[model samples]
Structures are given as C-alpha cells and as structure tokens.
Target: MNYSATAPYVWDPNFADAPDCLLSADQCVIQAQHYFVKGLIEIPVIGSDEVFSWGVWVSLSRENFSRAADLWDTPGRESEKPYFGWLTTELTIYSPTTINLKTNLHTRPVGERPLIELEPTDHPLAVEQRVGITMDRVREIAESLLHGARSESG
Candidate 1:
C-alpha cells in the first residue's frame, strides 16, 4: 500500500498556507512553498476494471501535511504508500462556500478521498478529481490548481 519503493511524490508544506479567504467564495490555497517528490500513483476506480495512474495532489492543512510528511519519511513507507491517511476540509471557491474536500484514505469509502475515481467520471466533480502523471512527464495540472488557489488568495 505504500510507494516507498517508488519514492512517490511527497510535498514539503513549508510554503503551504492556512485556509484563509478574503471573500466567502475563494478557492482553497496551498499557503507556502511545498516540495514534490515526483512519482507515480495508482488510483482505483469504483465499480470499474480500470485503475488510473497519476501524480497525487495532497491538499490538506499544514498539520495534516505534516502528518503525511512524517509517514513518507517512515523507513519502509514506499511499499506501504497507499496507507497514507486522509485529511478532510472545506474550501471556498467561486461562491462564499464551495468545495468540500474529503480524504480518501485506503480505509475510507470509495469516491470520498481527494484521489480520483474513474467509474463516476461523468460526475461534475470527476474532472477536478482526475490527475494523470508519469515518470517521463509529471503532470502539473493538480499543482497548478494548488498554485491558482495561492494567486486567488492574494
């Protein structure tokens, strides 16, 4: 369940900011400078035979981020990567209050965590949920979204 073997992408939340919005409807922000480990992740799709490969975008508060960091640093966390838990939060986007972030820890219910699932791609949230990444090219789309939140915050 861990990606320690692959040295999965891990983010350093030094630059991540607290959840703060000037207006009621603002996107969630990453806060400070974060570092990415750059690796592949397998996303499971509910009720589907296919699994998606993508870079994981961990969106969480500094506290939760710290927890994730600690897990990543664990001696044999790679092979046990999928064990990384979840962090839940609500982010304001567009309107005063929008975007409910649910952590999809391996233990949680399907389609609830931040990682994307394919079976429900038709769902409105599916688009935001899917993020693809490969060894040759690490998709920055998710990171860009993380950055966008930063820009909107200021």
Candidate 2:
C-alpha cells in the first residue's frame, strides 16, 4: 500500500547456495529485517541473524533436485538455463579441518499389517570450501553406522 514506507529496506541474500525456491523464505525475510534495522552493515548477528545459510554440505532437497533435472533435461541452452540444482546456501564458515557433518537414512520393510518405517542416523561430514566435500565424509558416517550395526548384530 505504502511503497515509500516499505522502500526503506530491501532483502538481497546471496542465493549462490540455494538452488531453488524451497523452505527458505523465512531465512530471506529475517535477512530483510536485519538490513532494515542495521542499514547495510556487514555484521554477523548472533542467534541466526543474516549469517551464512546451512545448505553447503547437505544433500540437495528433493524439490530442488527435481526442478533442476526437469529444467536441464536438454543441452545447448545450459548457460542461459537457470540453475536449480543442489543446496547452495548452506556453507561452512570453518572448514578444511577434521570437522564435518554426516547423516544416514535407513528403512525397514514391515509386513502387510505394518508399512515401512524409516530411521535416520547422522555423523560429521568432512568438507573444504575450496574443493567442497568428498566421499570420506559419507563413508565415515556409513562406516560408523555399519560398525554400530555390526556390534549390535551379535
């Protein structure tokens, strides 16, 4: 209704991390509020202000991945094509160290009376901003999970 009053602040986040329009509208809204109050100041606010997003090392959200696949199902128009692949917003401010994050998803099939149930396990996924993440992080998590299952097997 009032463009002047609303024009004081605008939201501009580096969506270099987000590949698609998914469950991050709130993040952008908060960033807009942060700018409204701070007036173009580059400061990392505590308690999840406009800090780096958390999409750097996580598996691409199913929605984004599907969108990318559909959009890029052709070639020769790659550059002009919009990029909607992977979770790009998530980043690790501190990386190249032994620290990492990982997760596991397991499912068990049940009988006719019961459907399938899913179980999730997580671990540290090692990553480097320069080169990105490697399979070691996944393997580490999987191995740890396997070891746990083995220990509990017998």
Candidate 3:
C-alpha cells in the first residue's frame, strides 16, 4: 500500500500565494520558515517480499534543508548524512496520532525519494517499521484507507 500527503500537516492554503512560501512535488518551504521534504516510510510486509510505503512529508531544520537542496541535482548525493526531522503527516489509522514522531531522512540517489526512518519506539508505526507486519494487517490498512472504515487498529 502507498499513501501520500500532498502537503505538510501545518500547511495552510492562505500561504499558497505568499512570496516566501513554496510547495512542489518533493519540497516545500512555508513562509521561508518551515522546511519540508517528501520521503518514503517503508514497512516490510511479512510472509512476502512486498513492502508498504507512505509518501509522507517531514519537517527538516533549515540547515539540513539547505544542504539537501544544495545537493538536489548533484550526483552521489546519497552519501550525505541523514537529516533529523519530525513526521508531519497524520496516518489516522494509528492512534495517539502519527504526527511529530522522530525521524531520520536518509537521502537517496537522484530520481528516488528519500527514505524515512522512524525513531525506534513502542509507537505502533515505529513498531511496524522495526518488525514486519502480516498480510492480514496490510489488508486491514487497505480497507481502512479505501473504505473509510475509521478503524485504528494499528
């Protein structure tokens, strides 16, 4: 399953016309203050080689965001160190919220989204990231997302 958020959770439509604000397929800057980048958070699917991914936005520090932008078109940019960020998408399937979780954005080769690694913790999302989830769980998630089941079983 792949889910994506078009903008950061803090984004507001009012800023869409602001000179200092910008939003693109993979990058964003709100009021030239909040910086964000799109990345993939992959969760392995058990009993198979498949993986579940979320095309999520993560807020990064200005310095890290600048560094990432500097290398955006540079080859071998994947060698850069991962940037610390906070999860800015709310995957409502999980309780206690999926926003503000600690994360490390690992830069990938050009043409690929960065990999988002959640901080190891007992949170359902983090737990699923550390340990693979069953196919049944994947189906449950799919149903919840597709059918608006509103189940928070994660």
The most accurate candidate by TM-score is 3
lDDT of 1: 0.33
lDDT of each: 0.33, 0.25, 0.93
Worst 10 contiguous positions by lDDT, candidate 3:
145-154
lDDT of 1 at 48: 51
After TM-score superposition, what is the CA distance of residue 79 in candidate 1 from its true location, in Å? 11
State the weakest 10-residue window (summed lDDT) of model 1. 21-30
Pairing residues by index, what is the TM-score of model 2?
0.20
Clash count per candidate: 25, 12, 0
- Top candidate (lDDT): 3
Residue 144 error for model 1, in Å? 19
Q: lDDT of candidate 2 vs native?
A: 0.25
TM-score each candidate: 0.29, 0.20, 0.94
Candidate 3 lDDT tens digits, 78-147: 9999999999999988998999999999999999999999999999999999998999998898888876
Query: What ranges in model 1 sit over 4 Å off?
Result: 1-29, 33-50, 76-101, 105-154
TM-score of 3: 0.94
